[model samples]
Target: MNSNTFSTLNRDLLLNQLEEETFDILVIGGGITGSGIALDAITRGLKVALVERYDFASGTSSRSGKLIHGGLKYLQNFDIPVVKETGRERDIVYKNARHLVYPIKMNFPIIKKESYNLVTLKAGLTLYDRLAGVKKEERHTIYGKKNTLENEPLFNSKLVQGSGVYVEYRTDDSRLTMEVAKTAAEKGATILNYAEMTDFLKDANNQVKGIVVKDHIDNKTITIRAKHIVNAAGPWVDKVREKDRPVTGKYMVLAKGIHIVFDYHSLPVNSSIYFQHKGRMIAVIPVGNRTYVGSTESLYTENMDNIMVNKSEVEYLLGCLHDMFPTLNLNIHDVISSWAGIRPLIGEDGKSPSELSRHDEIFESDTGLITIAGGKLTGYRKMAERILQYIEKKEKKAITPSKTDHIKLSGAQFNSAEDITSLTTLLHGRYIELNLAEEEIYQYVLRYGSNTEKLLQTISEYNAKDLNLEERNILAELAYTIDNEMVASLSDFYDRRTSYLLFDLDKVKRSLEIITSEMSTILRWDNKKREEENRAMQYLIKRTLSFKD
Candidate 1:
């Protein structure tokens, strides 16, 4: 970990820095959008500070389908500019954080005499590859019925004419956000999570100047001064905007997206599937020992913050799965975990939830409140770049161009893709004494990239430590995350940091006691605080067990 790493251990110190310095830019959200903006600002020579009500990516960013593709629906609607930009930007995301964002092949099946026949499917993919400026080697491959069946037997073959295999990037959305936040902090941005911005501080002319925030760690009120402020709060964008003034002209419309996870023994997927069942596009992606499928989109108004998947959503998704893979017959009981998030899409009159566009918008209020809302995971860097560009023009400052396009994130060590495989081989042999399985080591490599070596070296230096492989791995991850990743609580580590609460639940339960003990020691929690942390983890775990329709 870097000596100046942002973590719970330095909450007071970072808050002191925030209170003392009046930054050039103070961002009001710690999700990917705000994090990206902070990174761009700091790297381009602007003093920056970011505040999130909860942990970074604890909101919408953490609950996505976790893909880095411009929506195929966007291409179907002829959004060439957006598709082109995101296709280009995804490469940048991969180059910077290959461990978090990497290539995966997706199966999109064609139907006879339906919405997409073979000819239309092939033509659409051709245009899609062209719009994306895809390399010839990575372009779409049309698969015949026999090849399609051989590739994915889970999909229903009754109406399937053929399939198109195309390249799409998969990502750990929360991890990507955390790495971006860390990179921003590395470049001199004072990033604070679990810090809530309570109110806006306005100057004499009613133009924004600073903000009043409540620090959750210590229960203290702190005033942070800044020249410019941006509201990149995802689901709460409108609420934050209304705090500045009455939200007018271009309000927000939110939709709920729900996903369910199943163990590989119950239902397995060899590769990712982009299946359209009854006009909705659902992605069924397999990650090692488990297969997860989603998402059901429905218009949502209430329950904005604590969004949960409902029983109906679960049934609907299971029905969707049956539509594609009839034999699976997965029920709610088969679902190990479920997550739902509100997509803060830009509203249009009479538009249904699925019909609404996914394009992001910037609304600069009359009092100088800049609100950024409605964007996909893959386009976060560009969104941040645009926000910084807006500030540069408004403030008339000599701003430098963005360097994040090529900048490696906090844990990215390799210069190229092939370097990752070589890294795994070397680290496996080097850290064999740890007694962790080779598969587990590779997972660690994927999770932390070059930082895994640092974690192992730190662990190796400890003498007379009594811990098993699981406990030792948990302790190592907790140490690295706290020292380097700005983790604030047990849920942050369990839920977002490693995604253990959802995919790897048994590991979380197995490590919970050790996790709390270490967290208490690291954060200096008393008996009551320790109990509260445990209770919070329980509440979060319970939240993932149900869906809200």
Candidate 2:
């Protein structure tokens, strides 16, 4: 399968296709929700097209807590429906994308005189497992404080009573969304990034007929006609809705959540830790060689365009980290990288920022514009299913039922979790003959899954004998991402495509010259354009990590 069929080389062709074909569903927003909706619609025999103003998953999808959680906190709030739907959806997502979403153990430490005593904790977890449809063997476990401390000594053992262990699925949100987009493309969906919808193209009745969109890269405008349009633009849903008509009655509330990254050696922990700070639950998880702690939820109203992590938000997350694991002694300077994402929650005037609901809601305006908002990452597939049901009712068509539950995503070829492990080990051993480092091979196999063979082939075909192993690895990844993932900029490659900027800032700095030179060669950019791209990337990294004065 020539994935170059989905590359930027086909960008103009995709626009032409959009102009020529009338799709059943035209989805605006290339985030996880939009990707899910397109995949579902196309698999159901509907002609689907998706356009994003930025690169895929460059919005809230990329900046999530990176957990396909079952909403254990919702259980605390007695919100059973969301907990159940997202819980059951967790396994579905994991089953479909075994390489992207995998089981992670969460340790919820029981503090002294905390709101959750052992009895309440046990009951809540039992109900959680039941709602999540977890098997009896995979039920939540309660551990004594001694055992919990012995296993993970980083926590404040003095205040610990006991611990509750449950399952949460860890995911690379950007990669998951990318795989979904690729899968949708494979099923014959027209997906384009850097394409912004300027205005709604309406019929004589003032109902939405299609959209007038502009491609930012080529600076060309194209009109895409579709029978139906969906606004799944994550945080930007309200703005899209306002384009058709004014929002009345229920609207959206933006809650900004910020996360901080620290090196694993500085804040080492064996298991993902969930602890309460200021009566709100925050999580600290290990990703590769880095430990990331997050998510302080505060009402965000200042600027949606650029949601940078302020010092207060950083301080709040740091406080949460220290409050739970007092021995870490981390400060602001220890932060390697940080990200802030807005949660487009359904607002209730009475509810606090943290109390806002994450339930998905669909609003159908009189003009027939459908906007889907207020959903979580874990529930994206189920959310898409619900949207399709709405679409079927509205369109009055006999569409097929969703098959995403059984369809594995691109790069995921395993039948079971054991199969994934077996194949990964097999590929690791086989790739050693290609003269790659063991750890490098492991990372490649894990990131690309079964596609590691294709990447290895790319590595072998390149003449890089003079380059070090690390340089060769970066070059291979760069070639593949540019030729396959439609990476348009250096920042896109580092931030979303590779995640090198988040965990290894030093590596980004070191690889800058090589990457820019190679990208110039591949994309055919002149020296001035290459310098501009470099400056743009430097600003992106500096702004996110706040390294500049």
**Which number leads on TM-score?**
1
Residue lDDT tens for model 2, 431-481:
666676566766765677777778887787664467776687787788888
Name model 2 segments beyond 4 Å from true: 1-3, 348-356, 398-400, 547-549
Candidate maximizing lDDT: 1
With a 3 Å backbone cut-off (N, CA, C), the pairs that clash in candidate 1 are 309-547, 309-548, 310-547, 310-548
Residue pairs clashing, model 2? none
Q: Estimate each model's TM-score.
A: 0.96, 0.95
lDDT of 1 at 62: 91
TM-score of structure candidate 1? 0.96
Residues 504-530, candidate 1: write the lDDT tens digits: 887888889989999999888999999
State residue 224's C-alpha deviation in candidate 1, in Å: 0.7
Q: Which portions of model 1 show Cα errors greater than 4 Å? A: 348-357, 397-401, 461-463
Give each model's whole-structure lDDT.
0.85, 0.85
The superposed Cα distance between candidate 1 and the true structure at residue 211, in angstroms, equals: 0.3
Which 10 consecutive positions of candidate 2 have the poorest summed lDDT? 1-10
